[model samples]
Target chain A: MSFEKQKTDYMPVELVIGQHRGLLHYIIRPIVGDENLVDDCFSAVTEIIVKNYDKYDSSRGTLAAWLTKVARNGALSFVQNKKYAMTAGDRQDAARMEEVADRKTPEDHLIQKENLAELKEALKSLDKLEAEILLRKYYYMQETRQIGAELGLSERAVEGRLYRIKKKMMKKMGGAIHD
Target chain B: MTDFNEIKLEELLKETLPETSLAENLGVINPLGAAVNRVIAGMVMTTITLNFLGLNYILPTVGIMLIYLGMRTLRSGNLYFRLGWLTALGKLMLTTLNLVLQVTPYVSLMDGWGLWAGQAVHILFLLFLGLGIQKAGLDAGMTNPKMPTWPVILWQAVLIVLALTGINSWAVLIFMIWAWVRMVKHIYHCAADLKQAGYVVPVSTVWFSAKPLLLAYLAILLCVMTGASLLVHYTPLDAEKLVLAEAIGVKEETAEIRSELISKGFPESVLDRILDEDLADLGSVTDVDVLQSGDNTSNTERMEGYSVSVLTEDGRVKTFVWFEYVDGKHAGLVDSVKIQYDEDQVTTDIKGRLLYEKKGETWSADVKFEEKSRTYLWFGDITEDVWSISKYSFPFMADSPRGYFTWWTEEKDGSPAYWSFNNTVFNCLRTPLVLPYVELPENADRLILFGGFGSSWGQDKFQIYATAQFQ
Candidate 1:
């Protein structure tokens, strides 16, 4: 009833996962298109959520939002590992992760993190509508038709805006991106 | 080449975007935005006067629905929000009934207390809604969450006080509008602040989305309003079977009365179709004179007018302006006729009837007249004056249309009051309804009348006339 009383009732990780499991499933389903793998990716996302539950700071963001980042990353990694396994004679899980670790150097990781911070700052400078379109396309992994429908634009218009936005970001990042 | 893929942009942007923005973009509920909707709905539902195209009815319905939906989203956030949702539902029902009643003429006749009660319920709805929002912000650990709510309530109180005091001035109106704008901005800012603080509420799934629901409501309301308008467009008439026998008997009894009026120089065309009750009232019609009777020199239409005098049982002589249409072609072409009188003239009880030929016999059916009055307020005085004009629809092809008249006070000079005449043949397909444009009286303090305010009350000698010819 009281504000102090409510403050103590911080949400537990299980409750967070329980309430927003549908959201995590939505995020995972797109990347791991296979339904069976989607379930496996969601199970992996739950593991990450529990392991990092203590690190979640209420001041930083919401549980739903934090869970979203964890789910997206977990699902992407699961898909990459699955793809690598297919070419590597269906190698088991730990061997795939070790191979992925070998591909990126520690120095490379540091540079990428720094560049990401700079790109984040550049993103803040983009117009609000452009930022929304970019986030919906890349961050939320929404299809062009879905983005267009939500924003009341044609698919071609959304695609055009996305191209322009990506070009703008590439310039702002000092052409740091390359194939 | 950079080791970081472009896909890392999602990760970077995830951290960069505000939590509420991220949550909302991801299809999560923003409690503050829902609360702001309630504030906006409060503003919308209170406005009832700007009714062009029925916006007053429409906007309030939308506003009530927004409040209901907003409360539903926030109901899980706090107990106050649950109560607010119930109140919003009640307000929606009351508002819907009031809107339906507004389309009927009887709403004007209803007591003012019901309106006051509705206003009270609306205020309660806003109060609970605001409190719910404020409390939700506090529950979310927002600093100074009472903003917007307190300011909005203050402005609402000021407006209520101003309305109660009956202070009418442009300055006060401007100040109130400014306050409303400020309140709306404050509500937006408060919602933004709470959203930025990462306050999200669980949203209940709705069966129908907002736009479809609003469109459906508007469609229903428009249908109801149009149906109500059509219902009141015509006056109620008796079945043909019930009035047929009475009509036959009245014709026999009124034969002597009709002969007397004809001998006194009344037109036989006008006297033949007068209802027996009306004829009985005109029994002592001491005198009759034809004011105008002839074909127009410039046109094919024939015009006939009469002045009839009757001594009331109370012994007061009331002269009546009457018209008779004997030309079958003119009677067939005419659609509607209007009568007008000056503000000083005492005229009431306008009556009209259709005279049509069926199976080689002339028959009559009672037609109703609609009167519209224009009021003129005098300069620097509370005394108001009124001018009147009346019109009737001609539904059938009458062989001869008759019995259009209004009682009028005789002119002071004992001269026959003049009735002006104008005629137009309009293509019904191109122009369905024809209305005359009459200029208003020129007075310095008189309100400047605009287009379509053209129903005119003619010259000082109590001039009366019937206008409008049809094709």
Candidate 2:
């Protein structure tokens, strides 16, 4: 009942990661790019987590969902800043590779990098609203209502929009998008 | 050789897959969790601050902090920042409630500049909160932004008018209820989010329950309502008492006069003339001092009394009679003059009217006055008019009944100068009690009798008698 006791009993970062490592990598690594950047982002995220550990209210959102959102924001900030530092030629190459990778191949099941690159390309093609919804839903794995509120739409509206966008993309890929 | 190599590679890939996935998920989840946690911590802290320091001082500071946090959350693309913004909003409402409760007593704080200031602050903050919600929604990519509709705008305008015009306290109460409902709805939405995300939490079910945050809000509300209700109920009584007290303070200084008559000396016929004619013209006496005695030796000694009468401009006469016994014999004069007025006109102005005006020109001759008992009683021709004789009583020396009357007359411009009548009656016993009454002329624009002290026996000791003129 008391926040004071809870505040002092915070789990260590290593232990939290060890316990929920699967969900963390599934949600964070795609947005961050590479193991080294992921490690960097993780440290930053844990620093925030430890510093504001007492602030979390279980009433607002699950600990996992809240943590995922924090990680995503940090990763996005990192990616945006990195994009600015890259040369124009490098940007164009990255964009082209991302686009070409979107084409499906039977060999994609064996090539995790190719699948990831194609997924990122497909995400980029989405409208800003749709992309954000999908990111909050699948990427950060937040609840539909939370995404709806963040976006100022009803929960049903968010759910419908996400469903339609996914279906459209799935049709485009001959139902290969989900797999 | 090829089959052995493939099997070893497959095992290695399976172990690494869960590890990499777990790491990526942790990276995504931890940061958001941290941000949300921080915002919730801020809310709890703010609630505690509000409880300890009171809403007035803490709310403004919290509101400003919330605005800052809202902007930062939008820029940072952190949903948890919205929590700070919402908490700030709740605090702002509480602050407003505090201000309203504090200022409503004694004067209409909602009138004049304070009203405008309060409205401006409310509108500005409302706009800020709306904008913040819209931007957050856009960032999360849920739906198009929609402004509040015309009806909502109109409702807000009405609320503003009611608040500024010093409408009843219930108007403020309605607004408070509205705000509470909205906040509760939003809190429910947040609770739903928490539940969906697999966190267990309970929404507040009772209003003003003893929980820390809710109890604080309830305490503030209770204090305001109790104070306001007391002010509304007791103000008029206090005002009346103040006016009456002022009147009594001035009236106490005047001295009363007393005179006595012996029944053996005055004849019945001569006594009748004095009571009927002479008593009528006696105007504005400070007191009628009376002391009477009877001759016990005379077997046929007649019981004595006095009567007083006043003829009005309407050609009708009004009379008052008093009767009493002296030295084992009934002897008195009812035709005694007694008037009581405050020395200070300011006290008169403050006390206002409290007496009934007597009408007619012919004064009663049959009644008699008594001096020994300091009382008035009927001793007229009892066989001729039993009812009249029984109803009349001697006017007490200490009692003073004074009244003022005015009527409306047409002015040169065809407008009516409405006239007012104010009367005050002082009844004496151990202590004097004053009663006031006022009347206004028909078709007058304004009839104001500023002050009259009522009998202290009434709940309101001073009655402000006023009537508006109508054409």
Q: In candidate 2 chain A, where is summed lDDT lowest over 10 consecutive residues?
A: A1-10
Question: lDDT tens string, model 1, A100-121?
Answer: 6658777777776676666766
Worst 10 residues of 2 chain B by lDDT: B433-442
Error of 2 at B469 (Å): 30
TM-score of chain B of each: 0.54, 0.27
TM accuracy, model 1: 0.50
Best by DockQ: 1
Model 2, span B45-116: residue lDDT tens: 332334222453445444344333323333334333344345455545644454444433333444465556
* Each prediction's TM-score versus the true structure: 0.50, 0.25
What's the DockQ for every one of the candidates? 0.08, 0.02
Highest TM-score model number: 1
After superposing candidate 2 on the true structure, give the runs of residues whose Cα lies further than 4 Å from its correct spot: A1-179, B1-110, B143-471
| Interface root-mean-square deviation, each candidate | 10.0, 16.6
